[model samples]
Target: MVTVKAVVAGSFGGPEVLALVDAPDPVAGAGEVVVTVEASGVGYVDIMARRGEYGPLSVPGFTPGVEIAGVVTEVGEGVDGGWLGRRVFSQVQGGGYAQKVLVGADSLATVPEGVGAGEAVAIGVNGLVARIGLERAGVGRGDSVVVRGARGGIGLMAVQQAAALGAEVTAVVSRGRPDDRLEEFGASRVVPSAEAGASAEYDVVLDTVGGAEVGAWVSRLRPNGRFVLCGAAGGAPDTAFGEALLENYHKSPTFIAFSLGSLPGPAIVPQAQVLFEAAAAGRLRGVVQEVLPLAQAHQAHRLVEGGGLFGKVVLTP
Candidate 1:
């Protein structure tokens, strides 16, 4: 077995539970490829899995990264050798935090021209979610939109995509001095969360923040407005549906909870191709705020868990 290094989590706890350990290298099975991982992504979901909040999604003694980008180092029996040196990015069923990973051949996609592994992964799943979420929300020209957590990995790209779609966009941030960069990302205005209370005059609200605060944002939606609740960075909100919510806003505002988990699995990678095109053309982007060594996963986890990071935090394995 080829020996390689990976971040393995032995138990559910804080960042301290992550350990960089030597492990047997992966081998590609039929229709699979072994990638020498150049970058792995850390997101709120990775943090949730580490804390045991995902319940049964992960077990002790598992590696913990949800996305990866790399060069194909090996391919399985039926796979073509031409794939051997292709740079690729893919979302995996866990095990992304390693020097090498085995992925289904069909799941692999070439990195767009001129995009590095770190930047590719920074915009990988997170940007794809934003792209898809906006499409699912029917975001269109002349729509007024509000995106909570606007300076985040998902928010950064969401703001860009929404603006490109011709929506008037307002980005909501939680802290620090007002970021002039939000405008650069196509945000028409930046609203700090403290000031966001009850100010919702939006036609569509793409809320990544969940929890007790959701209603305040929802309250501002104009009649028949749509609010897409896709994240729980503050914590998952209390869920309600049907009549009670529809009656509150007079014109039947729509509340949709956007969860990739609830959808069929096969739909993810193919939809991500649109993101590749968007990024390739410079219409979509995400920031890679930091690239830490694989051994420093615990520190990376700590940073992602603490929140308010301005961009994606990637680990080079």
Candidate 2:
């Protein structure tokens, strides 16, 4: 009998709820493929889902991971046999915290030659979010952009992508000195979170951390500026930022809440391909802060929740 090992969340609460367990192996169904997972990423979103904060993933008994990279080992009916040995990565609804995972065949992205499985998951998923958010906000050369939570994975990518596009990027860290690498990553200036909304007006603000500060940042938007919310690791805004948003309505300020899930599967394939090639060419950088065994998923969750990591924490099954 075939069995699969996975980290299961028997109940939603803290990291303690996650346990490594064995289950009957899953088989690929029509339009699905089974991937032998190499590395999975742990992020603030996983922490939120584990704590029942994320509505769609609040259910118990589910494995909590979305960023996955692996080799395709099995294909379902109608799937191309060429996928049997391809290295791939994807973002799924759940079940990535396992030795193998079943995913839709259409969702797979080929991993480039030079990118490791860990780097694929780290850069692929976060970079996709950053790229899409920046594009949606119409950021371009010479735009003044502020990226909140710029030291973490997605924020770090946002900083790099915006700068690469010629935007004058300001990276806002939660506290303390910003990493020197953030500047190297293309941040023109590094500011503490408290200071990001102080004086400077920006053409675009990409917010990953949400709080009362969102209101302040909205007030700092220049005419025709865009404020894009990609994630809210700091918790949702409790302030009445709408009034501030309305104050700039005549100036044509744009507020956009972006989520990668809103996109179709086909939309990600080309983007992933570009990202993989960029990483391969050293144009894109991914930081894998730590790699832990699958059984230590609880520890991985704790580390992500505790914050201050410059990159991503990966779990190898």
Candidate 3:
């Protein structure tokens, strides 16, 4: 019998709950492919899922990873044979922590020739989030944008993506976080989170760290500015506070709570390819802070939860 090594959350609580276990190998279903996972991203959402903070979806025995880059080993009945042995990356509901994963054929994006598996995983998930969020906000050339949580994976990609789209970017990172890569990634200016409100008015505010500060950032928007919330790592804001922020009709502010999962899978597959090609060409950067073995997934979780990392943490199988 074939077995695959995976990190399973024995119980939802902390990093210690993540345990490496050997499970039966997965086989491809119709229209699916089994990939040998070369690298898997450790994201903030994985942390929430592992801690049981993602509501009913965070059940025990779940593997807590969402994105992976690898090579296809087997193709399901309806899949094209050419996909087998191809380098690819995909985003899934879960199961990315395994050495091998079953992926939908339509969800696979070919990794560009120059990009490594770790880089592909970093650029795959977060790049799509940044690109889609910026698109939703109608951000364009000459638009002034502020990216909160700019040091994180999605935020870093947002800075690069916005700049590539010609929007001037102001990255808002908490105090003491690294500012070195911000400008290199296309941020025109970097501001401490505490001082971001007073820094400047922006046509678009792509916020990833939502907390009590949501209201404050919304208040800083230029009239008719768009505020896109792609994540809430800082915690959700109070409803009354949110209501208060919306009461000012004169600002004509547009507020959007964005989730990539809400969109159809096929719609995003092409976008993933665009990012992979851009990264391969050096037009976009894939920031990976560290790569650890699958057995050390607990350590990866701890690093992600502790914060202060400039990029993504990836686990290799």
Candidate 4:
């Protein structure tokens, strides 16, 4: 029987739970295509899922990856033959941490001709999350924006994208980190987290690290300012805190908590198209900090948990 290699979480707990193992080959159903995974994305969500902190959707002992870049190797019945051998980026529910994955035909986005597999995965999920979050926040020219966790995958992209839109971005990051790139990424100001909420005035705040710290920023937002909570790298706040935030910050401030997964699959293609065009035009900067072999996934997870990485970590199978 055909088989493939994947990183399986044998049990939920820590990075040690991940193990590279052989599994049965997956076949494409109708309207799906099987892809040979060239690059699989490793992100915060993977770590959360592996620790059983991702709630009901992500079960233990499952392959965990949300996006991948690869070439189509086989097409299911009713799939277009032209897709064979074509390079594509796929958004999957899970199971992307394998040598081969079955992808929905419509969920596939053509990787730009000059883009490498790892780069595609970088701009695929992280890029879209940043772009869509900024869009939902209604960022515009001359708007003051603060991107929490600016060193992260999505935050880095969002900082640059917001700057490209003429918004003045302030990147909030940990102290003593490699932050010299914030200016290059179009950030006008870089504030350490210890002193972030002191400024207390911004048109928008795109937050990746959520918790009581995120709630503290509520008082910093100006009237009608938008606070977009796109991730909870520090653990999410509970409903009581959320309600209290709204009640205390009654200046008509808007709190938007969303994920890229909540959007429809077809919305992905168009958004991916825009990101690819931006990168091609040099409007957006690189997101991939490094790419490692798939076997090093456990190490990658450890690095992510340590929270010192400069950008997205990808695994090549």
Worst 10 residues of 1 by lDDT: 238-247
Candidate 1: TM-score? 0.94
Reference-based lDDT, each prediction: 0.84, 0.90, 0.89, 0.85
**What are the per-residue Cα lDDT tens digits for candidate 1 across 166-212?**
99999999787668888998999997888765645888989887777
| Per-residue lDDT of model 4, residues 258-302, tens digit only | 798887667788899788777777777667887888788898898
**Which stretches of model 3 miss by more than 4 angstroms?**
197-199
Each candidate: how many clashes? 0, 0, 0, 0
Stretches of candidate 1 off by over 4 Å are 239-249, 262-266
Compared with the true structure, model 4 gives a TM-score of: 0.95
User: In model 2, which range of ten residues has the least summed lDDT?
Assistant: 191-200
In candidate 2, position 185 carries an lDDT of 93
